[model samples]
Target: MPNNKIGGHYSQAYDEELQQAVDRLVDMGGLVLQQLRDSMAAFTTADVVLAKQVKKGDRQVNSFEVDIDEHCLDILARRQPAATDLRLVLSVLKSINDVERIGDQAKRIAKTLLKDEQGSRPSAEQLAELNGMSAKVQLMLQHALLAFQQIDADKALNVLREDKAIDDDYSRIMQQSLSAMMHDSQQISVSLQISNVAKALERVGDHSRNICQHAIFLSKGRNVAHLNDDELQQIVEKKRD
Candidate 1:
């Protein structure tokens, strides 16, 4: 396992910079989490005002990505970090991109809600699978961010495991939406909108899993993104001799 502590550099300033990068990243994660939560709430309640707010919040998330990228680049230029330190910077760089994309997915969900015509709300039965998927992806996102904050490979692996469930849920929702569309041609428009929201939630799960993969890379110094579940379990469980 990699070092959990981040501030043992001989250069005190270098240590501070690394810590600052982590702090900012955690802050960004928190914002994105709330963005997703609010977007889902807006969807469930058909709250146009909240959906509008979630859409507007995407700008701040984009700004966070740009700021974090600049900070990581500064570290790479000045510190030229190697080994674990290099992994830390590189993981932060990769993680921020996923976090920003998660934010974008949230914005897409919000946009789907906002675009619905008046009196075109989807019934709760139609939204059931979507609601389930929203909850799971939110939990996955929360755990993935926590894994990065704590540098816990086990937690990252758990997030990876949950990703397959999200994929399954997405497939189920698509099938249900298609069935609804086929049964009632008039339901096609509403079914299509629900499909869009489900797709956004699925993408959110994917982005969250990507963040977890970066966490694993940071902790293990191994890229586990393309690994099968069994292979990932083995890599994360193996101890250095």
Candidate 2:
């Protein structure tokens, strides 16, 4: 249903404007990636100062989202993009929002980590699990942004595949955390904070997957949003061949 191309262009200036919108979107995505990196580091290292910095950086991320949205609207209203160009514009519009949400998740992780008192900190084992989960989600975000930059469906599908693993990690972390809480009621607050951070990481993974889906839509002209892993794999393989 969606075509991927800049068709029926009125002028070179209009085409450049559309491309600029995409460039700006990519820039915003980069800011989100940085925020995730900083927030994860703060969570693992117990750096409240770095956490505070992440919270402050959220405002810039929010601004990027607004600016990109406005740019997309301007192109749609004035330039009236069609075909592949229209698909690209629509994908960028959706992805900006997704990136913004990822930024919010980073902020949430930072806030939760900052609230944790010294003696109430999660055990090293729990922190290790959180670190591993954070690393995986950060990788996902990196690759998702790369998929958008290259418009590579294969890369996007790879991100889609990663979502399941992150989900499993979240489940395992929660289960272990709950077990720890049961053994020591005094650790309940720490366990809850760990659980919250893990949940935030899971949400970042979900947003990364959404960005990958948008990349697939932009590149393949197919709506793979609702497709399961098996279905997505089939589509991806067919495209590769």
Candidate 3:
């Protein structure tokens, strides 16, 4: 719905500016998601080269973010997209920061691989589990971006559910890696690297989940991300009343 080629500026109309801003953000989200996925691949395969590539790509994501940020402000200034439109555009602005941070986490993973001067890899078992965690985080990112573009609150909530699972997996992998380190001094350094990567991935999950929360809020006018199921139910009931 966004077009860069639409030579004319936004008139006193809403439709033109709104679609352009949304389009730029969707492009930005797609790029950020790819960075997260590639960074995860870097950890899973111990592909330092791929990790570097993902790291380099973060700059583009950042650039896209700045461009979109400017566009949102311009739209707000020029069109004053009101009510739901204003909320959606503002959420896009806020969520892009999370997306950029997700790229940052991926870059952190790449840095871990590079800093491990010894070039050690995680144990095969740990690698397997880390890969699984990566897969889920990827899904969360994918869903978060999809929900944003689709404006689907249900899909956004699904991304929130995936966040809990990611944290659980991260904790499980950290425990396993730590146990290995305790048993042998030689593994201490590499295990720490692996743990750090896992933590980065987990944070990526957190950011993606936060984006979903923003999407839900934008679409349905609710802040369900911080609330438990019970609190959410009460809020829903109060709204009905």
Scored by CA lDDT, what does every candidate get?
0.88, 0.86, 0.77
Q: Which predicted model would earn the best TM-score?
A: 1
lDDT, candidate 2, equals 0.86
lDDT for each residue of candidate 1 in 1-241, tens digit (9 for 90 to 100): 1234787888988888887888888899899999999998888898999999999999999999999999999999988999989998999999999999989999998998888746477898877778888889999988998899888999999888899889999998899889989999988888888899989989988888888889888888888877787998898899866
Candidate 2 lDDT, 1-241, residue by residue in tens = 1123443466878767777777787788889888988987887788999999999999999999989999899989986777788898999999999999999999999998877746477778888899899889989988898888778888999888898899999999999889988998987998899999999999999999999999988888888888897887777667533
lDDT of 3 by residue, 99-213 (tens): 8898888889878877773566777777788788888988888888878777766677667777888989988888977898899888888789888988988998888878877
In the predicted model 1, the residue pairs found to clash are none
TM-score of each: 0.95, 0.91, 0.87
Judge candidate 2 at residue 179 and give its lDDT: 95
Clashing pairs in 2: 3-84, 4-84, 5-84, 5-85
